[model samples]
Target: MAKFDLKGLLNDRSVPDRQQDQKIVYRNPKDLIPSEENFYNTEKLERLKQSIKLLGILQPLLIENRDGKDYVIAGHCRRKCCIDLLNEGNDKFSRVPCVYKTSSELEEDAGQEDDIVRQIMIIQANCYRDKSDWEKMTETLKMENLVKELREKAPMEGKTRDILKDLIGTSSGQLGRYHAISTNLCEQLMSEFEEDRIKISVAYEISKLNKEYQKQACELYEEAGILTLDDIKGLYRQQEAEKGIPGQMTIETATGQNRPPEDDTEIPAETQIERFYESTNKNMKNYIIQEDKNMTIFMLSNLYGTARVRNGHLNYQGTTAGITFNPGRVFEHELSWQSLAKILIGKYGHKKPIKMVSVDIPEKPKKKDNEVSGPAKCITGKSKSGICGAAAYCDTEYNCCAQCPDDCNSRCGWLEERCQPAAEIPDEKQPDFVEEIADHPGEAAALPVMKNNDQRKEWLRNYKLWGLWYEDKNIGVKYYKYDFENGACLIAEEYILPGTEWMPEHETAFLHLVGGPEPECKGGIPKWTYHARYYKFPNSETELVEFLKELQK
Candidate 1:
C-alpha cells in the first residue's frame, strides 16, 4: 500500500504479466553510457531512431539511481539515442517515462545504496533473461573441457572426434569438438561465434591448432581479410601442412601497395580489440555517412522465387572500393531494404561495416602499374554480342553476374537508358540488337514493323489504356492552371527548377524514379505524379495484335 516501493515486486514476478512485471522506455542518447553495455552499431541506432519516431514510447527504461539521478538499469542504449534526438530540437521525446524502482529489495526511493541496487537489478534482469542461451554456451564449453580431459584419458576418441562428426554428421564426438571451439575462442569472439559469425566447425578447427597457431591464423585473416571461423581453421591447417611455406599476411598500406609479412614478423598497425567499448569509440568510426537519396535503383526485377531486387549504385573509388555485393544463393540471413545491404560488400574489403557495411578495396598507386595487389582482373575478353576481345563488361569481380557475356559496369548494353553508371557509351555506338529481334519482352509474341500511321496510332491507344498514360492527350509536362469558376486559364506559380538538370531517367519512361517517398503532386492528373516523360509501356502481344487489328478496321 506504499507509493515508494513500486520496482521491487516486478523484479521476481509471481504472476504472468510482462507489462506489470517490467516497464521499458526509450532513453536519451546523451544520458546513456555506451561503454561495455551493448553493441551499438549504426544499423541498431537507425532502427532505434525509427521505432521511437513512429510509436510513442512503448516502454519505460530501467535505470539505476546514480548520484540522486537515475542511471540506466537496462535499456541505456535507447535512452542515449532519445536524448540525442531531443537535443536536436525534437519535442517528441520529452514524453518518455522511466519506471521508479527502489535500488534495494526492501528500501524507499531515497536510499544511499540506490545506485548499487540499480546496477544489480539490471545485471539480475539480464542474467535471468539470458539464462537459456547462457546455459547453451556454458554447456558447450563444459563439454569441450570434458573432451580435453578425456583426451588425456583416451587418445583414440580425441583424434577421431573431428572426422566422425565432420564427414558423417553423426557423433557425440562432434559435440565435444564443438564444445572445444566454443571454449577456445576468446569470450567476445566466442559470443559472436555462438551468435553465428564464426561457425562451430571452423572454430573447432581453430581450437585444434596450438594456441599460438590460432592467434597467428587470426592475425593473418585480419590482414588478408575477414575469415569465417571455418575459414580461419582452414587457413591454419593449410599453412601447417605446407611445411616450409612459412606464414603470410598481405598488408595494404596508404601507399596502395600490399607487402607480405615475414614468417616471424609482427604487423606494425595491428592491435587486438575484444570488447564492445573499444569497438564503438569515435576514433574507430565514421563521423557521419553523408546521405545521398540519389541511390539510383536501376533494375527492379522480381524473379519468381526471390524478392523484387533493385541494385546498382556507386560509392567513391579511392584506395578502397566500397560496394555492397550479395552473391550467395545457398545461405542468406535476412532480405530487407537495409538488412541485405551488409551481405554485399564483396570480400577483402577493409574497415568494413556490418549491416550497412562499406566495401573496401585498396587503390592501385599509379607507380605500381603492375602491382596486382588483390587479385588480377582479366584485362581483355571477347564480348558475347559477337564483338571480339574487349573486357566483356565484367569489369569488377565481386558483383558481376557470371552468365553476363558483357561488361560488369552498371551501365550494360541493350537496356542502357535506365541504370546509369559513371562510364557510359554514346547512344550512337550502343548495341542495337533489340530492333532486329523478332519478339520483345512485353507481349511474348512478335509484331510487324509499323507499316502504317494507323497502326502506330492504334499501338499508342492500346498503350494509353494499359495505365501507361491517361485517356486524355495529357502527354509531356502538363503546365498552367485552369480556373473553371472564372472560365479562364491562369499562370501556375510552380517552383520549378528552371534548368535542364531536372531530366528524368529515361526518354520512354517519365516521372523518373530518382528515389523514394515521391511527394504527391496536386497539379498533375488529380493526385497523379507529374512525369517528365511518357512511359511507352508495351502491354502485351494481345494488346499489340488487338491494336493492329483496330488499325486495319
Candidate 2:
C-alpha cells in the first residue's frame, strides 16, 4: 500500500472537504453585550428591522470576546433591530450572524499600545450614519479622553495631538476646542451643550470664565431665556472693569470720573477723579456740554417745580406760582437766576418777596458827534466808490450793504447800526440784568475760561455730565449717554440710587417739563433722554459750567 500523504491530499481539489475556517457564525442575540458608545435612531432602526425581516442580515456584527462574554465592537444598531424582531415573535431573528474576535486577536488587529486606534474604530463605525452635533461632540470628547489616557500611560512624544487630529478627522485647532470642552466644561453645561440647549462656542466661552462667574452666567441664561455672544462679552467686560483691570472698559461718570468697583476701598475719590480727567481730553466737549445742560435741567425741575428756558428766558412754573427771568445774557445769567431762586426758596420758601433792585449798567463808548461816519466813508477809511458802493440799499448786490445809513451801499459798522430798529424795554416784572455768577453760590467769583487750545483740552478732560459720581462725597447721581440714530440723538441716561430713590420722580418732572414724548419704562424706574430740539450745544466752558449750576439747583 502507498503511504498516505495527508497534507497533499488536503490541498488536492479531487478530495471532498468536510470542514474549513469559518468567517461567520450564527449566535443568539441574548449572548451579545451592547456598546455604550452606540447611538440609536428609532426611525433608522425600524427601517433596518424591516430590511432584516425581508432579506436577513447581510452583514455580520463585529464582536469581541472578553472574559467568556461577547461585547459588540460594531453593528450595534443592527443587533438592536434583530433583538426587536425576535421580541415581536419572529423566531428567525433569534440568532444573528456575527464575526467574533478574542481579546488577543483584537489587541493584535489594532496595535496594543495604540488606544487611539480602538477609539478611532468606534468613531469611524458611526461616521457613515447621520448623527446629531450633540452626539458628535460626545464622541469627540470620548476620543479626547482616550488620547489623554494613552498620553499618560505611554508618552506619545507630542504625537498624541496629531493622533487626535487623525482620529477626530479635524484640524489641530478644532481638536483643541474639543479638548477644551471635555476638560473645562462642567457636567451640567456639557449636558446642556449636548442637548443643543447651549451653543458649543458659547459653552466654550463660558468655560473660560471663573467657576463663580460661570454659575452666575448660567443663572442669567435661565432668566434671559438665552445668552447671546455679545451679552456674554459684555458681562466679561463688566467683571474685568470691576476688578480694576487696565485694559477693561469702564463706565464714565458725568463729572469726568470713572465709577470704581464696589470693592475698591483703597482708591480715593480724588485720585479716581484726577486719573479720569488725566486720561480724557476736550475731544468730548460736545458730549460734556450737552450732558451738563441735561443735568441742569434735571436738577432745576426737581428744586423749583417745572423750570425751563423759553424764548431766551428762564421760566419757572411751580406748584405754588409762576416766575420768569429775562436772563439778560441768554445762558449764564439764567443759571444765576436759578441759583438765586434756590437761595430764596431755601431761605424764605415759595412766599419769598420778589423785588427789582436797581443795578448800575456799563456805559457804551460815546461816538464823536463830529465824526463823519456814514456809508460814503467806510469804517476802513476807504471811500464808498472803492468799497462795494451801490446807489441804494439792495439785496441783489452780494457785496452791497443793504442796511447802509448813507445812500451809498458801503460796508460800514455805523451804517449797519443806523439802519437797525431800536431795542424794546425788557419787562420789569421778570428778573433781568442779574450779574454773571458761578455754578454754585460763593464757589468762585468768575467761571474758568478756555481761551487757548491747552485750556480747552483741560476743560474737556475734567468735564462730566451725567452718571453716578461723588458730588461732595456722594453717589446719588448716576447718568449714562447712549448714541442713538447714528449719533443724531444723544440720550442722557439717569438711574436712581438706593439712598436717592426720589431722583427718578424728579427726572419724570423734568421730562414732562421738556414736553416731547413720554419715556418707555420696563420697570418702575424712569429714564430720560433730552431731545436735541430743546437741548442746544453750549459755546464756551463758562456757559457749560453755568448750565451745570442751574441743574444743581
Best by TM-score: 2
Q: Which stretches of candidate 1 lie over 4 Å from their true place?
A: 1-43, 103-120, 123-183, 186-201, 228-553
lDDT of each residue in 438-484, candidate 2, tens digit only:
11121212235445546544543333332221121122332222122
| lDDT, residue 455, model 2 | 58
Predicted structure 1: lDDT = 0.36
lDDT: worst 10-residue window of model 1: 348-357
Off by over 4 Å in 2: 1-22, 36-59, 90-92, 101-106, 109-120, 148-158, 220-231, 251-553
lDDT of each: 0.36, 0.45
Estimate TM-scores for all models. 0.27, 0.37
Q: Which candidate number maximizes lDDT?
A: 2
Mind giving the per-residue lDDT tens digits that candidate 1 earns over 1-553? 3233223333445221343655545444455443243322323466667777777456565555545655555555467667767887887785466664533433343344443334334443443232323333443344344434433432322243443233223367656665676557655456556455555555666776666676776676567655566566566655565444344432233243744332322211111111211333342222211111122111111111232222222111111122111223222222232221122111101221111001112342342322222222111222222221121222333221222345645422443223222133222322233122212112212334667667655544333222211111111221122111211111111112122221222222111111112234345622222222212221223333333443344
